[model samples]
Target: MSEKSENLVEIRHLKEYFNVNVGFFRSKPLKAVDDVSFSIKKGETLGLVGESGCGKTTVGRTILNLYKPTSGEIIYDGKPIKTKNDIREFRKKATMVFQDPYSSLNPRMTVSDIIAEPLDIHKMSPSKEARRERILELMGYVGLNSEHASRYAHEFSGGQRQRIGIARALAIDPEFIVCDEPVSALDVSIQAQVINMFDELQEKLGLTYLFIAHDLLVVRHISDRIAVMYLGKMVELADAKEIYDHPQHPYSKSLLSAVPVPDPKTARSNKRIVLSGDIPSPLNAPSGCPFRTRCAHATKKCAESMPELKEISSGHFAACHIL
Candidate 1:
């Protein structure tokens, strides 16, 4: 979270494939994340947006080493992360804020206990008094008071539960955080507050985030750069404004067009590009480009060979045969 210009985290050819059983003794590999590569700079927010089952969450989890990637290297601070010791060291510097707050927190434990769990595991504080102080500090940082710390997770509202989750993630003072749809489950009004809190917390703590969400509007607001995924492959990646204004890939263009324009004039002028066909199963994904099945611009070449994610413009990247 320091003001370092160097890349904080680098994922190279990251792949996460799950084995799916078909026949009595036969099982095929489901490529959840297929040859994906990206990097997050220090103190920058990288937004990852995609439809359900596009491997957005899988990328985040795999980066955290929670789900062991089938292949590829994860480099952090110039160190290649492999083995349990490396992952454990990485955990001290990296953390994740889950999407569902209700299911994330333990119902039996109090807020203080839940927040202090990381500190306890890491042995951050030597004394009980020091641990209490750290827990209180985290609560206050997330806009929770000391009185609320004694209460259980079930007692809080949806937004408040997420705040608790945020507090817990911050407890370890991690530099990089994977915010997995932190505000998606919250109400519209509460979403703004929580989003603002995340923004504020980032600035104050000098934190970096891989902000993953389904809502393009929310992602655009918080992310410095945006990456689009379709069927376990990254189709587009560029600056947030550039992606919004001039999306290159067919899938990327379709996604940006789907974001509802507020103004009547703009809304009327804009045409929504609705994609046909359902997302294919990762277990039986297309041979070439994974999105070729749904992409209108797909051709014989698209089905015959896969397209690599190449830079179309400065700092703008997309994977497609056509521009």
Candidate 2:
């Protein structure tokens, strides 16, 4: 994509922290997303992969303004997202398909009503007939049949329900979508179908995505660029092929190593870098480098100061003292 089309969503030094009460009068803040930064280009997929509590989901939520960020900036289409009105306007252009298909949907509402909800809220359609037509169009776009529209969410399988969710996201004709683990909860075969649908939808709609998932293999398959996070910080960001072939950060290397190779011969040849020790709590995260405790190349300097994300090569960034 051209540079003009390459920066659809720009996030800079974004921070989201939650205040927690410890004991009598004592309290600490939990830094869920700490100064994380990245951008998703139009028609490009930026895959975010990390451990369960590494703030990947938090990043997506904060970007969509689902959670109020403590600090930093989110600029979409050259406008800063800050005030309630700014976020309200931004919502018209952005939407999300949550991780869980079963819970994200309202079990009480029919699939048709669920998809139409956004259209009704946004007032995208002029008349009742216009709304019905738009909803059917979105359903067909996501590979759902019009016949199934009247049925409730429980009547559909995991993949089908996810399709309904995707249809709802598209109802607003959004330019951006936070696809939070859209396929993780499905069967292996169903995962492929749902993922493929997302790819197709993006192509047809010219959508930008912040695709968050723990599966490195799936992320690599769909992403144009990939960002890896450890604790609350982004450790590495690079093009998908570059990251898969040449990971720079020690934490990123470990993550790529753990993705099982399909070929038995290649899998046998690969070395798995098993990390020791558990992840530090967000309540009391380690000072300086968060990944230093598990880094084999760590030094005193690594613990003394946090490494800023610096350019390692053209379009590749990493945070490391040794690199």
Candidate 3:
């Protein structure tokens, strides 16, 4: 694949599969992320949205090399990350903010130590004083005060804990971060504050992000572009506003229709496109498109062969037989 200087991270045909035990001695390959491809520009946020167990988190983890990919190419900053040493080097420039803030942090560790862990592992700081300064600086960047540094993770509120997680992710001064549902565990009111903080940090630090979430409203707010995933495949990808205003795929339209509008009149008039049946299991996915079983527009062609994601318009791509 050709390298683009403007792109910070490029994922091509990325697939992650897990072995599931079905019988006493038999197992099946569960495709968590299958043949996914996309690229994030320098200092841009790509929001990944899907229902639970849609492999959204797996994509983020795979990009950061947290989960070993089954087969694919991951390019970072014009270099291909293929070997162990490359992954080790890539870790310094990439980090992840996990889904659950409460479980992501160690309860025994103080906020200072938690944030300083990355620095300690990478030996980025010259001395103890420098590490302490870095930790405090990161905390301050995320809206935490110096006094809160001594407190343990359990002592802080849900929002505060998430801030600490963000601080830890930022401690390494990473260029790219895989935010795997960072604010999902927090209260509804706290969600906006944390999301806004992410925006501010991205602007202040020039960070690139792969934000994974189930909530369309939250994703639309923080993302420049959004990619909709179903089962283990990408259904549609486009600019956030373009996807919201004119979602082309059947599944994408269904997802956008469910986003609750604030205005009562608009909400009342909006038609929700309810998808039929549950998402097919990845282990036993349909032969053609992964979403065909639940899609209203599915036809005989949709069952005959899988649809390749094609550009219907400029910068808008969708995998659908009908379109």
Candidate 4:
């Protein structure tokens, strides 16, 4: 596909596979992210949702070049990334906010030191004074005070620790960030606070994001568009509202049906589409559709060949034989 000027990040047929040793001196390919493709416009958030182990984290890491892609192309800012130097240059503009705030940060280092690490590595700060000032500025941006800078990450609350992580991510003034379930470990109240901070930061910094999470409510709240993955493949993708209001794929419909409604009346009337059978192992995935085993609408045709993701409506895409 041709590059679009508006698209800040483009992923084409990205695949990440790991070799598992099944027996002595024997290994098999475990597909993590298989033939996934998408693009994010500048200053827009793309929410990637799927069940645990659906390759959500792998996709985020692959885009950041943390885990080398088994095969595919990653284009950032209209340029293809090919070499270590290219990745080094791209790192300046792209960063990641990891899932677990506690483990992601260095327990031994002071908060100020942790936030300043990126600046030191990239040589963004000219002198010691400049680095200190930049670290303070980043801390302030994420709602932390200079007083907290001297403390270690282990001393802070989960929310505060996440804030520090965000501060570190912003130290280099990155344009694109892959937020890999950044608030999943926090309390409900804290999750809201951190998410709001992310929104405010996005608006203030003009930052684009690939927000990966399993919570549909959180994803819907932050995403301009949403993509659903099933067993390492994208099953559906569309505007957040479009996918929620009118889900075309069976798996998408099933997932939305499970989201809890706050209203009693709505909760009582909603029908939950429960899928039978557990998710298949990626190492021994089914021949055609990975979700065929649990899909009520699955047919012989569905088992015959793998369905391609096709546009079924304006700005909506799904991979289904019935569609």
Candidate 4 accuracy as lDDT: 0.95
Q: Give TM-scores for every candidate, taking all chains together and pairing residue i with residue i.
A: 0.98, 0.97, 0.98, 0.99
Give one digit per residue, the lDDT tens place, for model 4 in 1-323: 44398999999999999999999999999999999999999999999999999999999999999999999999998899989999999999999998998899999999999999999898899998999999988988999989998999999999999999999999999999999999899989999999999999999999999999999999999999999999999999999999999999999999999998999898999999999989999999998988899999999988888899999998899999999
CA shift at 168, candidate 4, in angstroms? Answer: 0.6
Instruction: Record all residue pairs in model 1 with backbone atoms less than 3 Å apart, i.e. clashing.
Output: none
lDDT of 2 by residue, 1-323 (tens): 36634689999999999889999898888999999988888889999999999999999999999999899999998778988999989999999998999999999999999999988887788998988899889888988889998999999999999999999999999999999988889888989988888899889889999999998988998999999999989999999999999999999999999998889999999999999999989898877999988888989998899999999999999999888
Separate clash counts for every candidate: 0, 0, 0, 0
The CA lDDT of each predicted structure is 0.93, 0.92, 0.93, 0.95
- Angstrom error of the Cα, residue 46, model 1: value is 0.1
What candidate 3 gets wrong by more than 4 Å, as runs, is: 1-3
Q: Single out the weakest 10-residue window by summed lDDT for candidate 4.
A: 1-10
Off by over 4 Å in 4: 1-3
Q: Which model is ahead, 1 or 4, in terms of TM-score?
A: 4
Query: What's the true lDDT of residue 216 in model 1?
Result: 96
Residues forming the 10-long window of minimal summed lDDT in candidate 2 = 1-10
Whichever of 2 and 3 has more lDDT, that candidate is 3
Cα RMSD for candidates in order? 1.8, 1.5, 1.1, 1.1
Global lDDT of model 1: 0.93
